[model samples]
Target: MLSTKSFKGVNVFMSRNLVPPEVFDALLDALKLNGADVFLCCDPSRHGHNDFHIISSPDHEKFEDLKAKGCNLLGPHCVLSCAKEHRSLPKQGFTCCLAMDGIKVLASGFDMDEKVKIEQMVTAMGGVLQTKASVDVRFVIVKNVSAAKYKWALNVLKKPIVTINWLYQCWNEHRVVPQESYRVLPFSGLTICVTRIPADKRKEIEKIIIQNGGKYSAELTKKCDKYKVARRWGHIHIVTRKWFDHMS
Candidate 1:
């Protein structure tokens, strides 16, 4: 399986496989944002090609697709060994010959067992193991923003660790139904849940959601739902399980 690892805040990788275009783009964007550099290596022979070409110019006609996606091509140099140098240089280098500075190895197509061995070596040297999913880092609004904002609050409620169901009950009590949505980002393991609610009531719950770290849930259950009702008639009621039981 292909996976990613982060080492000393650098991105490094050796791969015989290529990641999806979107995932690759995400990785480049993240590297640029974090001031990390990249070293991509592949064996042209493994790809079963000999007449290979490397495009280095930013506006190179051969790399229109990669350029359009904001990837700036640096100089291309052949990976040569003592024997290979005596022969004609291939367009691309083998995985072993590729090396660069300021790069923390990111992803590899190595098998799982080998990857674990590599990971152990890295961690032993104080490096970190990032899931292949996280190699392509992307921004997440839920954990990235303050919970006081209702949009973030909704996210907190949906997180796995926070099993609060009261918020959902509050919305239901106010006749508000939250439409369910999920965002699967390149970098995150869990699909982020986005709920739709009325604009005005957002501030009511956003106040609490950000304060809790992805550990809040919607209050929709009788066993633990705790909702507060605010009526235009100035009547406020603290909803509890007993009330739900009594009604049942």
Candidate 2:
């Protein structure tokens, strides 16, 4: 399907790699769902030890049938090169770099010395570098997906913040270690009033509190400074000092 056909300013370039049978199934599904077309690059080296076969009937099931055809999988090198070149078109848009198992690796990692080559190719094509997370297939949207990237980064870089909020709401949700990471910092000499559960639970909670420059209470008495409640984790809430202070 490498015919020189284009759609919506986006070009599909299938690599010479022997795509796993299941992968082709997913690809067909994605194409139909996203209304995308296909492009194929012919490379003998990528065909493994088996000869290349021309698949005219590109359907989900047909793609799956090719799985046991016994050909080895091809590397993504051809596709990566095409994507780099595609980035040069002034209106080519974004080219998403995808990988398997929702694990994304930067195309730049393939050949670090060619960094300028890829960047220049993208700049000329009016696109950017982005990775996609997909269990079956990953790819970049080739446009400004910075918002998506930021969302991913937040979850990865601020996992502790997320864990803290999650554990605070329901200390019993996960193992005690999670709760132990959260501490209630006392302010204005107010003893934090907390529900005293068990010795182990109290110890874990107290450790988190002390680490964060806070104190813990053994019982929910009126003399307690503030109430530390692990509430439903709202990611944004976890990032705030107010949440930390309140929890502490």
- Find the candidate with the highest lDDT and give its number: 2
Q: Tell me the deviation in Å of residue 218 in model 2.
A: 19
- Candidate 1 lDDT score relative to the true structure: 0.31
TM-score (all chains, Cα) for each model: 0.17, 0.22
Q: Please, what are the lDDT tens digits per residue for candidate 2 over residues 177-233? A: 332334222231233334534566666666666655444556543553322422432
Query: What are the runs in model 2 whose C-alpha is more than 4 Å off?
Result: 1-9, 16-20, 29-37, 42-246
Q: Give the TM-score (vs. native) of candidate 1.
A: 0.17
